[model samples]
Target: MKSVIFSFLLILALPLSMNGNDFKGIKRITANESQNESNSWINFVKLFELSEIPEKSLTQIACDSKYWLWINEKLVVFEGQLKRGPTPNDTYYDEVDIASYLKLGKNKIAILVWYFGKDGFSHKSSGQAGLVFKNDVLHINSDNTWLSRLNKAFEYTSRDYPNYRLSESNVRFDARKESFDWILLEDNLRGFGRAKVLGDAESSPWNKLVKRPIPLWKNSGLKEYKNKINFPFVSKGDTLILTLPYNAQITPYFKIRSDAGKVIDIRTDNYRIGNTLSVRAEYVTSSGLQEYESLGWMNGHQVRYYFPEGVEIMDVKYRETGYDTEFTGSFTCNDAFFNRLWDKALRTLYVTMRDTYMDCPDRERAQWWGDLVNESGEAFYALSPSAASLTQKGMLELINWQRSDGTIYSPVPGMYTSELPGQMLASIGYYGFWNYYMNTGDKETVEKVYNGVKKYLSVWETDEKGILVHREGDWYWGDWGTNIDKQGIFNAFYYLALKGFKNMSELLGYNGEVKKTQEKMDAFKKAFNAQLWKNGEYRSETYTGETDDRTQALAVVAGLADEAKFPEILQKLKTQKFASPYLEKYVLEALFIMGYEEYGLQRMKERYSEMINDPARTTLYELWNIGSGSVNHAWSGGGLTILSQYVCGVYPVEAAWKTIRIRPQMGSLTYAATENTTVNGKFSVEINKSNGKYRIHTLLPQESNAIVMIPVSYKKINLNNHLIWNGKEKRNQWSEYLGIDNGYHTFKIKSGNWNFVAE
Candidate 1:
């Protein structure tokens, strides 16, 4: 027997500022009013040379919804998602350090502000389109004093998509209508005048914006993709087809010189583009060279430019999807396709992860709860250490938007918060909040939202069958594929929520309330199975006989399924109908929990064949094909989560990572390796199952307690040729649940590695 092992070093923590509550004196400024509504796109530039680069410089910025603020020529920040303020009238601003992007002298400051008067998920303008900036070192503000013109190349799109009403902007650029050197110091400002300055934030329509305990959006210094594609001039017969090897949200800029008014239409398969003001294939050639820099964002896999028999594009510098923070996690295996799939899933997380967990960066840049639960919610634990707290901020915002009656909405602070009965406001959103709680043991968060959780639970009463019912015409968005199965799915999610609430109740010392919840849960579980379970699987509706894979997935995770029925439910999912990538995210997770690791891995390979085999795809798509309008959807990145929970099997046993569960189930692969960093510390694992025996090498940060569960009977196993009786073998859904007894085997042994050779 060994002693308790504690070897990890304490990680240094960095403090971050939250949303702003005070902005009394800063004036809101906009483009000169004479030009207001004159063009959809406004280009503003101010040239200033620094005598000597300052030791430090910070800039304050605010815009309608979308703005590209560049310090010098380098693209500094392409902030797309912003809330008005925490409240109804607050305007939001960002403070960024510009010292690194600036030189000693001769620097250019440029801004391309896109005013989508027609509200979209990412933006809802207060009618007046504007930009504001102020920096003591390099004094600046968004006012009429800056040179500006409405560039006609960027045109507002059809905005035809459903969930987000995606602004499918068309780009038809005529260089002749362009502003030359718009981002250069040499651009003439003689025509520039006073910008129609709005009153300071306090007096403006957007008076106060959310000042979070932790800001959601931070500059990760987005880096260009390793592979950059440049194409030569081409005409109508030969349209330039440019596709990314993966999915990302990027600002695609190009240089072109064409005869005045030569039409070129740009077409895109992705639902959202960085710049919607311009046509993707429509290029109106100006007499001279005009550089087109899209302030808007485009997220997709393939884009093309069609020249009208003559218009020519000089060259295009296309950047891949943008992401913040540094990637600290890694995953690899013996299978090459699996590795590629892992890479694509990781990219999906990166592209869809902005200020919050976007459902899909390509279309709706809104932070969705169920989507977060499936994808960005867990991936945050891996790559986004700096922004992971953003998830908590998002959770608070959901509760912040909770109505007095306890009903919640989908997109927070939108034109209509109570659009439909989405799963987010009901039960799924809290499921994600629990995940956040487990990863980062923040009691304040639980305390902050406890009342809201209670109120929300009591908002809707259960039917005679004990299923939570929604209002007539209420849209139940459990999973896109769970059509009309709201009853079954919602209850499953409610059960999951109750379990989390019960855990929180104990943690927060609300025993009396938890007991009532437990009683209700006990009753609901019995009623749900009786009402919904039919044909061996749960029906989505009471008498409609509808069934979806998501219903079963949620049932398994939510504890609504009977222990005896696990085998039948697991078999049904293997041969079920298809679902969107977002829905599949949960389905895969359910399989992992049931110890169907091999089937899940095999299903992932067969389902994600396109993403892995297609050379055009650089990231995972939201659907099997580009038809769904999103190539890189956050919800589709379930593989990364699966790898973490099932393959690497390192999960939090308590709030934060005080104690963890290490249950590695290497499916078909002979070897699996992964590393992740949590608030607790870094955890790394490597496993090799060769010659019918297993060898596991593990690393855990300081004083961490763990329940390391693996297969193999205790009687037949020997640790380094020594018989060990510390772990108890139990049979559950898995072949064997190796109960990890922290009291026994400790990492106090040298190297913290162990071997279990078959005796």
Candidate 2:
């Protein structure tokens, strides 16, 4: 048993503002307008009016335009030679600083676009531009206003480079005779105007044109097209018919609702060119709304519909008919219980995880655990008041899938044909299980999973050092292809597993194993510290002299380092500037656990904000960087677990079965809340902290006592039936049950004013 050691550094620098909040105020402009010919150049100049041009400097401009920006006849930003569609390597928008280029009064911004084809074309249609300004912002609304122009830019172009021409092609045609030009003009003094020029002058050449027709095809027709159909009223067992008409091939989208306001069915009729398609209809007798889709013929006239087996008909509406057509139909949809958007997003994540799992045949079983680990955790966090049950069920599924030899395979079949370090999956799964149990206080689940998890840990222990050893191939391909050798993080996780085993064993009256595991833990800690720590910092390896790596940093943060060395470790973290974005997020978590609150909080804010700014601002990522993989990474999401536990100060110590210790450090955040956190049983906890006051609302299955840690210098404190003062007295309480289990208790603290801690 060797101690996993690492150094810590103090980060004192203020958080950097990557991009100001100014971008959030800017209006969204679309590139796909129905006014343009299908697969032809779209004139977008009529969509907006430039007025009251601010005199301030422009900080940044994000637009998907193959053109130039002219403020009062001065070229500010020029993205030359528009390529077709979005290139994989192109940065989505031109984030330019035109602060030195913008003018005060009336200014003119002109754009010239060519229609080569639709988004998929290598080079065809063109006429897309958006302007990001400094002071006054653009407002887009439902009404067809100049600023209200809508285009499905993200659908066709790369989200990174919004202006790249995604429709490029070489059809061996005369460029002068076949190509067309799309142009737009924005005059703060004169409003806006647009025109299109065809290579063939006889092909309806553009002149002085009035405001173009609103591109109702993409955004106008359906208010909530993706949602289950909303119906005003419906009768039971009625066959609802939804028809959408189009001059060419189109798909009719509709939602069905019952008379009782329940969604009954949804149908889509897919028709080819010159064909009228209709989808058949059926009705079921369910209490809630049901959704479905159908494919048939519709010649801009009659289209059939379909319903689920037990759903009754309520109402229906045509969502968009085709990708390239402007057919619109009207109907209502039933109110759905669940949010369709959220459900769809979750489904997308599931599909992505499944697909990624399929790609790695060698790590199927491990991948399964990995997927389950993330899915279950997300489910737990997502569904409020029901997270505990869902978490339990998900954990049991993993437990059931465990192999008899204590190892778990990747989720996919026939993956990881070789004996790799399957323990990584087991380690992560156990962590999730333990976390859920601690949060919900479910003894039964802990008892159920404990043996399997212990067995899994047991198989990995090497007799030579009495330490868990994972082979080389089993290591995760993380930061710079670094090979792990008895890695620090792995060792820390092993310590956690042993701690869990000890707790469960004690609870189950398995005294002998508990003592044995405790002895092993102590020995492991000693060896780990002696071998891994050197020169006031934790070395990356016992054999190598590399002093600072994320793994070593995390090990120290995870409490695997000797307590006596913590102060020195903390100093090292500060010196190393641990707040660098290049560092792994898990290392940040480690710092938080080591009491580097300011440093950790700053890093969290930066990382969280970065994630939010991304086009796919998701709670998870495959790695910190975008587009690293086809699927969002599960491990990155796992970092949230650490965030909730440490930064939010929601500690679920076993000593106090019913109490949750909260020590919030939200800098400058006016309001913060986390909900539906399952503790033990079917219990839940929701925490809200604002203006220096913290509140903990509990939804427990049974009455239990909880110990809570509140900030110092509070006017008053409250617990369910107890009140304790801070300082020496509270320190005594913490020491008494430092590593022991106590009954349920709820404690809360309120501070009168803000305070800062000095390192």
Candidate 3:
């Protein structure tokens, strides 16, 4: 029996090597129900008994749809990512140590597994479906021995726009349609048939279930509710609205005791203005104890619910999502708006952050590559050190999903990534590679996936201009604007990719690859200037003679322009019109690059100021005006990343924080302090301006070198009044230049705290 699970795993699998462990002894199981799988939606209930519990009893399992296990009716991990299945392989298994949840006597185990069993946008199945449960002393694999009955209440349905990417199902739950509590040891299964077996053969790869060599992806669950507002008519009338304090990831639950055969229409938000998940429920039992259960989860700042007219009155209870992690970093100062924005920015990331960095809790819970890049920009320093694991997992997951044509899907592990463009692949190679390597100094990851990523990048390389042109089967999403030529943005990202390979070359001792990549990158930049630079700013469209924010922003930040053109570039860059929070990240980086510290901070405040008050936003928003996209988009929190790395002046110049860099851009900010954690260790910095004296205090990571930069427009500078750094009369692009260009002073110091007062 153990050999049954280990035979094929003993051979080899492409993704299994990366997980660092081997397959556990477990047999894949399924009901022998008829070949028409989707026609009969069924839950396989397996009843297994253990004579005695072992001291180290551990249970792990993986199923196609979703499964809830009851060890004496004690639920595990509350119900997880089983429903939105990610191409079930060896990596998606969930393992839990059930030593404490078990008793010595005859313990019972029952699992209700839901299989969508159909092709859709979310779960594009590999076809073979089953469940495998493994433990040292006992086993309960899905087989014909398991009790199976068709579940009639759930009928999978699709939706339109706002709820489009949602893999939703309409639940017309008839409790009378439900079988008795077969989950309990005492419930009778009068006419249940045994589940037909599935995934049992060794020759077919899809028919096997292997142990998860790596731990399951991290789960940063829901947020703690501020205050729950029940609409005035939750129980009294048909229509109701529950206004949350701010945007949140929530699961809606309804506990009702209505008369039998009553129908109720429930919504997760207001239909006319905001996104809402529609849930339909029809009661079958007359009020003993019944639940409408949870719909396919919803997220919003304010949500509305409708109960419909002519339904009998019943009680209701609503529960919010639970907080999975406590954010550890802090950012605050004299300005209340920045403080509020910083706090909300952290929430924005955490709200959408879970096992994967979901783009939004709404619509697409899919992982967007660049969004993860910007997410780690703040998440690394803001959340606990443990949270870095998610970033690691995210990068690996993308790499693990590389396609045969050397193309990695842009929004990973999704069925619809069939057409995302080559430009969309930029972050996976550049931002993602650099962020992971620098933050954690994990080279094993680089060693394992760098070649696959390079292959992915190879799909876009061309010989004519050393830059990629959109070829067959590519999609372009260059922010939200009509006139901008997305190609310019694509070139900028291409520059970033070449640079990523160059960096990877230096790290891996591939000196030839480094020179080759650098040569191509240089040629690409030269071609960029000749083709796109028009009248100071980079022209957005190749022939339209138009320029927009993203084109210039991405080019400048990617360093496609020489330093001589920066001041000129910034002047034109800031003038171009629109900005979405996602694009604003690159825009912010470009602003700080040209030393517009004051201007950058002002832009951030102006854009997010309204979000700070009126309703006192809990997370930074998807759009500048609010109510546009998911309220907690990952890239929206770029403010905190800007504040921590640029304003407070703490960043890593090399892989890991081995050589720390600090160049504070305190344009109008009088004082600020920041505490952040990295793979190397914890570090912080503080700056205060009193009267005419500017005091700077910094705490560098214990074993790393610190590169500090001080802003001194007109100064005879001194470190503890001894003069460690002096301002030059020459003006560099990196200085604010209050009549002088060399207003900023740079320093390299050893680990430990240092203080300097400049005047």
Candidate 4:
């Protein structure tokens, strides 16, 4: 039986050379003759024989939506292709290396394409269906020679589709209509037709093509449900419940035997998180035993399966997948609550990452710039260096989608194009674009985006008093909750924006811009303090609402407030509680920046108690109260940044971590440790504050330097057990000591492991 199958595969295959290098003039092919419909699926297959597999084979593949490729029944690329419109009217392509997957002879390539033929908040529809494949080394190019057909088995579920905010629709697959043997390239593909050829790379609808900016997703193959093994034989009208180890972005898979036409429904616990439409799938079984898995992804802790009256299930599982990134940075401390919060934040950040840095995996996978600003900053201290590429991609998208009038809106490459002034300001401000550059040292990106940032900032006009005349964009969103001091928040953000732009201008040698932005910054600061500073709290004269903690937090964060007023400002933050989880981060950061490290740590724990302590949740929630909001929001994980950078007390002073500051703010905690990776290398530190003494250990990366600071209260300090400081005077081996700064004794050390003790 095996020999007969092998002989049949050889006869239906075509022999091709492994030495073609031409990529031009390859046409886009589709099985559909007329215009393609929304949520369409097409299957393409090619068979070729190779005398010997080459050492290196690379292929470039482009498609309208997304495609999954299989080389000789082995999955090579899963869900390959980025959303359309890097800029308007252009598409992105994937270049995959297939060298290892090719065999010596009788190799087959099968591709399944899922074309999202409609527009949404994160995707732009091309209104056409096509696939183009070119292998310069193996000489395999897709054209009319490839056998193709529309997969009729794949269709929309009978239920309503996901909300218009989502590009993906509810998927339904009928096993009876699909022949699983097609992947083996069986004899006589009767219904398959010659692919209809479209024009070359420069063709319309998909005008210009750019390479995919990020790496393909990391697939965790198939992982069984950890919470349950006895998946009850769900009969018609019965449901099966299973749970994952935690919340994750995953596709569902199961095998079962059922009578024909028995339908089963699959969804996750977060199918309707935030009370918004997510995604689900339906599978119609054929007679006898069969297996099926979905390609669309859904995220949650629990998986639910609803069976109509007459189906028998055998096995069930899921395949977890996410953006290609690793946790090269981590933080842990003496408190279990803080440690648990850090772990949850890390999970939230990872699950929300994919084609973009989404606010959440469900509801809408839109790249809201405000969320991206926080997400990008968190990535620097949590994920590997490759994760920075996503931030770069989002930064470019924001500027590339700029309107002629210098107005920039986010959640782009989709239908909704409204500019939220605060979000837009944050996108280009000190902690947004400038912070990304400071962490990654990508000078080219700063140069490319400077002009756009300048143009957008130029649109604002100030009143005679140098106060910004609040100009509302399409949306005037200050924050989520009420009692928002919009005028005060706008001025603070503008100052930060000017500061970031001025720094960029200096970096790019645009001295004229530097001078202009400095003047603007000076004017704004002068006006803000002169007009908004009343009772030691920053609020506009025209506002008559309650005190705004968010504005005060931004004032401290943007350096618009003086240290002399921190006493009163801190009092206001203590009494006011209007900031949402998103804005609450700024408030906590302000506390850390103001030398109130203990209070900062306490506030973070108190504000995140519900999310951190919930036995059912493994990730943070979109709101502090966790009411009707997304349970997994990356923006809410700002505590991760606070813990690593403040409590662990490790942050970069120079771009790409060339120079770092290790000032451990242990607060009331007795011990803390962290390992953070940068473009240069990994930096790890551990600090123990017990027995009325401080023991500090640090391992600095090569080509990097650290300025370590210990409290001035430590009367005597020793480095490597050698006396370095004796409170009043420096000892003989005190070369590493720098003078005191802001109540701490500082030292500069080079690239090696160093240990210090202070009493």
Candidate 5:
């Protein structure tokens, strides 16, 4: 009782700053007096005297759109804050630990806030240029005490502007109008004034506050290019071209000596990706030598700088940055095509992650939830556990944007609130929310969005025969290719959403809800067969086009079609090539799920041969043919998940991988090895067949269990050296030999390093 009392007292004594909303009396402050428009930049500086540095000093910062921080004139945060609106009216704040950058005595802090004044598909306009900050330990709060100014040097570029899908605009910086040394000290404070306090933290516009769920970006500080363009090269009226090794999200930097007002236009080859305007910048020279790194990021393989004939380039480089994660997952096999395909898919997945799981970084950097479903699944198999937070953020955002009438929309945090019925169904279905919970074991997140999921699913209804009343909500988009078969595909997706909700209900111990959900699923399945399944394929009466591989694939994956239909569907998939790359993943997965491992691999190779064989391609395209489409699409990287989950066969049998299954389906390959980081720990497996013997090695994390299955072709089985199976009976020791299922010998194993050989 005494200890409990002491713990309660300790909690009461803890600093209020522990919470992101604990801004005390801190106010939203702004510097813009002139009419603030789109693409506005404001610089702020604050000086404080600290007798001695504290052990730890964390700061809470809230801004309208985005910010960059500097402590003692050293770059601390490259970009901070998630795009606002956890809900329609809420805002997000960032908590950054500034202890390492702090020092004793007089210290200076600088911030550059870029307010995206216009609303786009990904950001909501706050209608005011404001910032709120608090650091109780450091005795700092954003108020009238801070000095700020509207930067006149930063202006909208006269060049092409980005389309409405994007929130960012092309920036043009006039070096003569501003002083770069203002960050160092108050060397030039001509236009500076005290910051105007707007109101408290709970003011209008930004009514609610939430902590940022994902980590700040990982900044790869200025790196020189490997493709040498020989520094100090003088230009002669032509554009200077420097190519990065591959497609990347980067900020271009260059230092050059040129005459005043000579404009140097900088952009990437993909400034107009998918034939749509993307982000780029321009640098107007001051007088003599000047250095500038454009804050706006561009994506492409090559960087081009158009100069006016007389500029002498001293050095050129760029900084690469992306979502904070490490490539802990890996896949390799004897086949080079599959290896290269997996590599390209993994690269594409990483670039598509930033503010949200983007459809494509070069095009609209919007969170199309259909794209997010595939991206989240791929993250579990390709990246470390840190990537899971991004998935959580996306799930929350998708649900938070739910409308009152039980409808949901995507490409959110901004203006595009139109519902894409098929995509919305996929977003809340088994592959999106349930897959995330299975891999992450985040029941809290599940609980947070469960009501929203139930609400969205409630909007969907069925006719008298129990077939879903096809909803063409705002957009009836099914896939990017021909022969959509919308009616059949929507039925399959609705069933999938019902199935996922039932599982979630079961996990949450909602017994009544589970039973209710299961009844709906069963009815839907029976009605779907009666209405859509005919002539060995599940094509609806409404669909008159060719049999859609995507619809057939979804029916198989969702278990809506019977086992009798598998052979016919297999034949159709073998001959048809109508599904886009987005739906192709499900087709490949369904083939694997049906035990057509060889055919699954063959289809993968055939479908992705062009992307794999291209010498210049480092990422997958939005479509299979790759004509006038985005080069880096997250939905197209579903192969990354297929390669790791099916080819390597390492998947969670239970939530958070408390139980895992190692069922290697290395079709024709003699050797295959793969590893991926899970919530439990790192799980790896290597399999090879040589000299009439199959060797299997696995590393399972502690406190977990594994179910290992080896092909029945190898009659004699040995574990570590002891003969566990002698072609007839089994001798059990550390492993319990479960009865064979589906032409393989099964064993239940505890977590540890295990090696098995079957000869």
Candidate 6:
């Protein structure tokens, strides 16, 4: 089986731009007297006066006191909690999109924010309210208010609402004494009432709200420039320049025809500080335009440009943009330590796998093992490094806690009650260790861990049914605390284990053991195929005889399908009409492996879109449903991996180490870019595209044979001194063979020559 080498850095530089409109500013408000609050409340009411009534989308109204987001006085979101902080339970927050709720003009928005008590576990402490646009643009208002009377009422009643508790009946008569204190922060935008504690002097009710300036696009006076300009040709010693709209901040990008319309340059400098109208240029041709000579200028709203002599222009565009406030979080010594420590851990795992197994012990064995393992591990670790580390530590603790009989129980108390499948667990560890070794090529560590892994596997053998008997049943435990029959994933792992055993036996010069292991592997594969595959598709179980479970999808993704039947099986799976929230990820993986990239990307986009829109989701979750807490599962991390593999098309080919084939299926994407992607060890790749051309920049990790495949119409491959193969019969089988080396290597490719490296 061919292993794909992925590096941690490879994913960081993905060019999927986040919509910049989501961030909005917050203003603080103070509460003094009810009448003063009423004046402040008028300003909040202005929001509705400016728009038509009955907003269609939901608006979130979060406040310390009794607050309601009113659509023409009809409360859409009401949170009457006299508490301090955000609700610990995930359900308290409301995210409503009110696009349909608003008319052309004059809409009323009102809020009554009050301070209850010291910021506690309620929604009051960090009081915040906002409106979200269809584009995810957010406008945040005041966060917290402190009113003494409200606190008394809240104390009298142990419920979020001061007036009533839905679960409990008796209303405190003193709750009426909780006169609402409104401290209004006045600003041109909006103002809501606020409250103060008894010990502190009642702050004056005044408007302190600061309205954010409307975006430049909303200004009708601004000239709209959306035309596409292209340069016919780019020759040596030639420079090309184009004029663009100049603002305080300008985003300039160009499409170069040389790489099949790939984006050659993007200027994001000075974007965050403020908008600036400026012209910047990079040399398109060395002879005509010097690097410094290709420059432009931003003169107010008009952009002027000058290109060094001889350079031809392809296409130019610009946009007005802004930046979000920088986030500040804690940093610790452990952060730096862990950065190095994880790499070291990866190296250790690699060395252990190499010395124990792998095809080549002395020549490139550890390197291969380390490369594969580190890449896979890095993919998951990059998403949530903390979680990855915890998982590693947990697995290690489990390993150490194994009993003398080789039975390993869960380390987390009450998490599991049964012993682990001794053989299965050993196989998983070995596989992980092997991947680490393939990524780093650490032989010593591989040798150290080899005996233990081998001994563990050797304890089990094939039974009359040809299954690896005595192995633990269902090691994953159904991922939801239930253990059914031995699962397909576990069975696949068993096959991999047998394969690992055979490799180890040969690597250690144990020829007799090797023969036996190979025989066992063959028998296992045959029995597994016979039992699990029926009607031309893989099945999830032998007992129920069902083939529609998600596990079967995983099997396909893991490359367990027979090559001849792969296409048909994949088509069937796609047309099965099975749509479950839990099975989307598995289906996506299977589709991606089957080369259904377009479908896979659509599925991924739908999932992420749902995640972004779901009010229940503040951050990405493990599953789509509410009341589910597997929010940190490694399986969810697979989305990023799929993005890298399918969308970006940065695949690993063992024969070619230097070059990666680019097969982008991102539909309707006018432009795209990715950053900081690491391939082989030190190599990094940056890809940018606009129109149809792709500009690919690669950094080599070590000296190795590299092959890049570009689309058939592009002939720049020859210009770049790269090989061009136009085999009609095997147009999709282009490949590169990188020689041996392990440092950072770099190269460039264009879309037109993509077919040269397809396979």
What TM-score goes with each of the models? 0.82, 0.46, 0.84, 0.95, 0.96, 0.42
lDDT of 3 at 398: 69
lDDT (C-alpha, whole model) for all candidates: 0.61, 0.38, 0.62, 0.85, 0.85, 0.35
Q: lDDT (0-100) at residue 268 of candidate 5?
A: 84
> Model 3, residue 594: what's the lDDT?
77
Candidate 5 residue-wise lDDT, 1-759, digit = tens:
235323323322322112445665778888957356778899888888878888888888888888999998889899888886777778888888999888778788889888888888888888878788889898899999998989889999985799888888887899988756777854556778998888887688876667777778999899887578777878897988887877888999999998899888988887876668888888888899889999988888888989888899999899998998889889999998888988898899999988888988877888999899999999898887778787787888888888999899998878898998888888888998999888977787788889999999989889988898767999888898798998888888888999889999999999999999999888889999999988878888789998889888899899987778889999989988898888899999999888888999999999998888888779898887767888888899888888888888889989888899999888888888899877778789999988888888999987889999998888888888878888765666679888788888899889899999998
lDDT of 3 by residue, 593-614 (tens): 8788888888887777766674
Q: Which candidate is the best by TM-score?
A: 5
User: 248-296 in candidate 1: lDDT tens per residue?
Assistant: 5555666666667665545456643443222233445667666664444
The runs of at least 3 residues in candidate 4 whose Cα sits more than 4 Å from the true structure, single-residue gaps closed, are 1-23, 231-236, 728-735
What lDDT score is found at residue 744 in candidate 1?
22
The sequence of per-residue lDDT tens digits that candidate 2 reaches over residues 1-759 is 001000000000111111223333334333334344332222233333344544443233332224344444454533222222111112122233444544445333433232333342122123333322223333321112322222222122211121221232111111222111222233332322222222221111111111101111121233232345456544444544544332112233433333332323322222111121122222222233433322211222234444433443444444332111111111111211112222322332222231111111111102344344444444343433232343343354345445666665443222222222433433333355665655555566667667777777666564355445644434442233243333554566567667767767777789998899889888887766776677886653443524444546656644577557767776765555322222344466666656666676555545544443444332233433443332233344433443444444455455213554545444333233333323332333344555656655443333344344444444444444233333333432322223212222224322211122211
Q: After superposition, how far is residue 114 of candidate 6 from its true place, in Å?
A: 39
In model 5, which runs have C-alpha deviations exceeding 4 angstroms?
1-19, 32-34, 186-188
Comparing candidate 2 with candidate 4, which one achieves the higher TM-score? 4
Clashes of each: 57, 107, 9, 2, 0, 120
CA lDDT, candidate 3, residue 337: 81
